[model samples]
Target: MRMVPMAEADLDAVLAVQAACYPPAMQEAADVVRARLRASPDTVLVARDADGICAYLFAYPSRLGKVTPLGSRFTLPDRPDTLYLHDLAVAPRSAGQGVARRLTDAILARAGGLRHSALVSVQDSRRFWESLGYAAAAGDGVALATYPAGALYMARRLSA
Candidate 1:
């Protein structure tokens, strides 16, 4: 699958692949996507194939640095510089491929001109994120994960 900038035409297919990859509580609904797209269009990316969307990456600028989101409260800051990756999902049917990496490359490409780091709360796939050069969140008590199967708060500083 090839990575692409998400557009209005790709919303339904993107959401479908997202739903297939993650649960409702963790995935953004159409309304949320609309809101986020309007406010933060630079933070979304999608990978597609002949069938449809295969993977996606969602991000937002965060000035709060690496404040880990626990439960429902996310530590968002106004006009932040750091790129916070909210989620990365590849459809179950597309797991073995390099879709996630290409999607991530798209996010990194977007974040390249920024001044802050790249952050992600990794879920059920610690090794995957590690392979991409993301490490556990800095400092003590940073290992907490809210995901049902648990996850790690990981980040990598983007050279500015």
Candidate 2:
């Protein structure tokens, strides 16, 4: 699969992959996803192959120590110091194929000037983010409360 910017044409497939990867309660609506795409088009990406979109990563410019509550629309910080990796989902068919890693690396590559990167690890995926150099960070307890049980806010410093 190849990494590419997410386009409006890809929303259907993106939603499908998201549905396959997350439980109903965890999934964001199309409008919310569309708003995010509008807010930070450059940071959102999709992984596609001959079959179609196999994975996607939704990210946006944000401040360190900030948490985007589940289902909330993205808001670009006035002075972003970090890239917030809001969501990453790979189709069930593409699991164990390293698609998630490649997609994440692609996003991190675009974050060259940022001072840090952060994410909310859900569904017991903290170890996966840990392998990518993210560590659990102190987060707003109220903001974190929006997520399902066991969600963690993690961060890692990025070299400029």
Candidate whose lDDT is highest:
2
Which 10 consecutive residues of model 1 have the lowest summed lDDT? 64-73
Give lDDT tens digits, candidate 1, residues 22-81: 766666567766555555677778888878888777677775245544333244576676
Candidate 2 Cα RMSD after full superposition onto the native fold (Å): 0.7
Off by over 4 Å in 1: 64-79, 138-149
- Distance from true position, residue 79, model 1, in Å? 4.4
lDDT of 2 by residue, 98-157 (tens): 999999999999995999999999999999999999999987778899999999999999
Give Cα distance to truth, residue 84, candidate 2, Å. 0.2
